[model samples]
Target: MKVLGSGQYRFERVESWPNVPKYFEMGQPSDVAINSSGEIFVLSRGKHPVTIWTPEGDFIGSWGDGMFSATPHGIFIGKNDNVWIVDCGAHVAMEFAPHGELLRTLGNKNSASPTCEGRLVHAQPFNLPTNLAIAPNGDIFVADGYGGHKVHRFNSKGELLLSWGRQGREPGQFELVHNVWIDSRNRVLVCDDENDRVQLFDTEGKYLEEWTLGNPSGICIRDDIVYFAQLQPFEDKSNGRGSGSISLYNLDGVLLSSWDNTAGGNKDTLIGPHDLCVAENGDIYVCEVYGWRVSKFRKIQ
Candidate 1:
């Protein structure tokens, strides 16, 4: 891991984690989440299973060796401290204990086949089910990103409640609904990555409002601030592997600040920043796909 930028935004390679195996190499780590104990769990696209590590970057353990079909994209640490892994290749969401015990799995292995249940259409032909967001009451929202271009909502027990949207560039439509997050007010925010915007909807899937972002990918909410991993399109012609940037917005959708690898003097930079998580102490952990690493930043007042 290379440190980039200056001031309070400098990136430092964590050189001393306790349990990391010296021989394990990871693929593009697309997303990341930290547990209450400060352990870091990374979801990668390289292999079938994901990797776990300490906040200090020590590899702890891994699970789900051969279960993923394509690649695992989005992941979240629930309020209950359970780990939810979204395997896009298999089009399903698997839940596990914080201790890596497999608890329950959702969705069909063959998602290409479509099935209907009453008024709810359960379509497995959905391409990539990327990221997920859990409500305060335990309702789960899955972004059917790559293939189907829809959002699937499920109850706490894995029962499908409803699904919405289709592939399109128009409002109320998503070309690639890559990620989802439930705000403090319970509003569902969907990162329409390909469409270059964020769409907000009610809990029942009704469109409320939308805002523009520069090729936004992973999204997370900490208190009143919403954090977005902005992956600028190729046309930007930025320097470094990726100009991996972070955009901060208020609850009412006000742009507050933009932080990047350029913040510090170092230029190792952030490339393909796919996901992000904020620690309780205001530290930001960004996972980059092409960079094959995770960068951490502390928020300074």
Candidate 2:
């Protein structure tokens, strides 16, 4: 069996996992999420925008054929198994029922907030939003990415509550806020991707601290552990293969293990890792945008 990582974090790769249908072409799996029933939901820019599968890699079905824009960026499953997807190209975020019924939509379709004029701009709703997270209190936090540098929080009713962050290297400012996640403690974690760090904030958008992860693009929190799927390191871009990796950290911001292989020989190696999710039983699924693949790593230790 092909293995990666070490210590309590070791994982064995599952070869050719999630048997993709021969009739379907899975363009680039932008993000992945697991529902309460242990079903895997992959959001891609493929023919079928959303594909569902069992944990055992059996294909179940698909959804959202013509409902989404050409670029679907992220997927997050809530406690009720409802799926939230962010469309960067359309500049909107949407919520859907497990069966593909559109529940709600946020932001104007194809309308981006004013951000291209300058780096330091605080915009409204979304400007190419990338990902979202729902707090236990029912507040929705969105990472307005690509064209903006802010995080917008909305109520459960889809009403805008507040927005924060600017474009800078400062503590509260963000460069590319790619993803957002709310831990069990209600701490708001935003992936400051371009700044190569994850910024922690209070529910009211107060700056707490930050952790330096390499171009952290994706974030997932299960129990007390935080998982990050990072993009290629800035220093190793000349490697040709592209060096991307996943990092695990404790709730208190302590690094546990980071696994990667720039040489690209190992099956567990990640390239252009844009997003990740942990299964109910601790299995890991990582999506690589540039590599055009999603790798499943079964927990070994």
What is the C-alpha lDDT profile of model 2 across 143-231, one tens digit per residue? 98877788889999999988888888899988898999999988999999989899999989999999887799999998789999988
lDDT of each: 0.75, 0.86
Highest lDDT: which candidate?
2
Worst 10 residues of 1 by lDDT: 112-121
After best superposition, candidate 1 residue 126: deviation in angstroms? 3.8
- Residues 1-301 of candidate 1 have per-residue lDDT tens digits of 4443344334443332224465665667788888888877877766535677766666778876666665778789997789998888777788998777888988766564342221223454345678898999899998888776888888898888888887677767887788999998889999999888999999998999999887889898887778899876442445336665787788899887665655455444566678898877667788877666777665553
**Candidate 2 structure, TM-score to reference:** 0.94
Task: Assess the local accuracy of residue 184 in candidate 1 as a C-alpha lDDT between 0 and 100.
Answer: 89
| Candidates in order: C-alpha RMSD to true structure | 4.2, 2.2
Instruction: After the best TM-score superposition of candidate 2, give how far the Cα of residue 15 lies from its true spot, in angstroms.
Output: 0.9
